[model samples]
Target: MADELELLRHANPVPVDGPHFGDGPLDHHAERHLDRLLRERPTISAPSPPRRRTRLAWGLAATAVVAALALALLFTGQTTAPAVAAPRPLLVQADSTPVPLRTLAERAGAAAADGAPKLRKGTHVQTWSMGMSDDKPPITLPEERIVRWHADDSHTEIVVATDPRHPGRPVLGGDGELVADGHVLSRQTYPPSWSDAPPQSPPPTDLGRLRAYLQEAEYSRTALNTGELLHAVATLLDTWTLGARESAALAQLLADTEGLRPAGQVTDRLGRRGQAYVYDGTGSRQMLIMDPATGDVLGLETTFTEAEPEYGVKAGDVMSYSAWMR
Candidate 1:
């Protein structure tokens, strides 16, 4: 028993004594993806484990944890990726008038009345996140993931390390090497499932129910902060492609939210246009990108609005960004 407990002692990659204790790797998306798969229908959703700090790192620790210490072994061997700085902020139109979240919510509610789409259960997403640590330098990694669910409650997932912004350029690989050709890191299928949880089960479409659902999904309390709400949004979309009523309800919920504000229009990293919404948190800033016409979420970006010298994160540096593609 002592030996077994000793083995467990080394399992914690983010030790409390470590510089980045309590921080999570870039919204904890990778682990969320993994747990989703293990639950029978693997889809990227809210992370189930210890809820991380608001100033998310997305560092080497999560990579190792998600890969079951494959990167951990490499990390101990000092084979981690090269240090890369954060990317530039998404370009927002400086002159555009601010649009209130309520207005968009109303537009979405109207659109839903016309005819709501019963979206499938899955995710097609693109993400760029800066992974940082006290020991290793920050590197911005880009990848795309697609997850689909079948009638049997089975699901499929595929992750490719490529960025559409600069195709054919040398991209960073998991082992911290640069590969000229982007390749698939993983392709997997999860057989029919563990439990019918909040995310795997279709999300509730009613406004009141949806709020409760999100709170439950993220293991959060009733009064979630700006960042946590946005996290819930990303995780929810990761699990289900919201239909008309759900989208409308979500828009209204966000509309009623207090801290969210419109920051004008901007082009996302995917080159598509979107309206940007900003939420300022304790030590970071989150920009939510949405399709104006449909009220569909396009993407979300988190930036280090304040510098953390301990982790080598700078103010204005992008901590992570994820795009929920249609």
Candidate 2:
């Protein structure tokens, strides 16, 4: 290989452009000595190409590129790669026997009004969201397992039975502060998930403050505007963040409402499904829709009423709603 490379190097060696350095005869001892050194030293095998060789090399390169492109097209059928099919919207393997939305709403309503414990316990196979965790990223669990919804006057808790991956119990308590009451209890919080900092901002202007203000106001002294109430509801919906209980409750509410549109249902980062409602309070022109059943506040849709398309408010379009999930 070394001998072959040497031969190739000699054959391909580039010629000097300038006059030869050894044209004249050696005149002195110093010149003779330098000449001798030059003669003794082997010439470096220059890889530089002559003009004809350079042109030939470029031609070959261009030909190779064209051939490669043709081969690629032969295999792929296009110069550009094919567009990946939009990931099929994840089709959750729903319960073979799903508890009706109305059933859930009735139970939630009863629980809210009478503080009666109305429970719906079943097994849920779901891809858990990271927002549901305190330390780890969201992971998908592929198995049927027992899970229970415990509802009472003030709160509802979802408890997932022990599994090998997460042995003991994984519980989401909603009766105010999530109390881990299950054996080997693992608790999940709402928007508070994985957050270590305290909530520092002022309470939301429309929901927290306005609700308080309305409650404090004397109903006899001033007649409340239904328009304003609708507005407040829209604000509440906008500010809402679905945790374990909040999201479920919000979904129930949207489903229960007689005329509300529940289409753009969304799951949150925490994997709760709910929707948003937009309306001009005190008018026939109201827009009520659910976000995608995957993420919080993803988008919305209007109710059955045929409203102008111009009124459609979409995800990534940030217009404050008149109310939100409390």
Candidate 3:
């Protein structure tokens, strides 16, 4: 059951490395394509996670935690990518006022390109809905998870856990040229038994096989773990709001958000009237919805990775997710 849930959770979403950081290796070509679009367009929609209160809180806290760690990682080591030129886009003028999508795209691109670590970092707390086996549970490392990432021409290094208790104890891996050079790193959760499965019926459908591909490709850990769904949503919205055509595939994603459901009439705290893409999944699904016009995400739903007889996911269940480019 646990394996099945994990399989579907990861089947369609971006791959994630582990609990903290992910740097396996993604489709650089595909990422570049998305980057090109964002760098040339003026407006785009931002991504958000399911709106369940528990889940929404987890997502926001996770992002805040990672964002803080990213700043630290940036100061320790610089991540450099080949500089690419910006693209040209159409501009319109009305009543002596001119605006170009190119400008928006450039600003977004510069932000991404800069990728500089912030000089001043803020403290953010993260809460997780963790579940382990009945007989033996997965151990929580400690408070203040320190997630770190390093990307160079050769490899990407990701480390989790930096609190005083376990100072530098971390799980690490890399991909791209590192794998090409035949440097295979061993798994961290020793004995593989750390993630054992109970005797159960048949596994999930073939659709679940996609997870193996995402894992092999090395997507960001948060993306696969359901922690970064909102980040992806925000990125999408950022693009869509800029006048980018909304793809049907992404519309479906909006539909599945845990809190968003079709309604005859809907308005947010700000009183904007329109169909909102909200997270509506169980376990605090009411908090992720917000006024799409303003791009304010307020909540998240919870998903515990480990097995639990009482609260965690069970076997024979099916989970579906969709990803898109605006």
- Compute each candidate's TM-score over C-alphas: 0.74, 0.22, 0.23
Task: Using TM-score as the measure, name the better of candidate 1 and candidate 3.
Answer: 1
lDDT of each residue in 11-86, candidate 3, tens digit only: 2112333232121122455345433322332222232221211111232333443454465457646343111111
Best by lDDT: 1
Runs of candidate 2 with Cα error greater than 4 angstroms are 1-230, 237-240, 254-284, 292-326
Which lDDT tens digits does candidate 1 get at residues 213-307? 88888887666766788998888887777877777888888888888889999877666677899989998889998767667787899888888
- Ranking of candidates on lDDT, top first: 1, 2, 3
Which scores better on lDDT, 1 or 2? 1
The per-residue C-alpha lDDT of model 3 at residue 205 equals: 16
Error of 1 at 56 (Å): 12
**Window of ten residues with lowest summed lDDT in model 2:** 48-57
Candidate 3 TM-score, C-alpha based: 0.23
Best by TM-score: 1
List ranges where model 3 is wrong by over 4 Å. 1-129, 136-155, 162-299, 303-326
Return the TM-score for candidate 2, rounded to 2 decimals: 0.22
Clashing pairs in 1: 25-58, 26-58, 36-42, 37-42, 40-193, 81-176
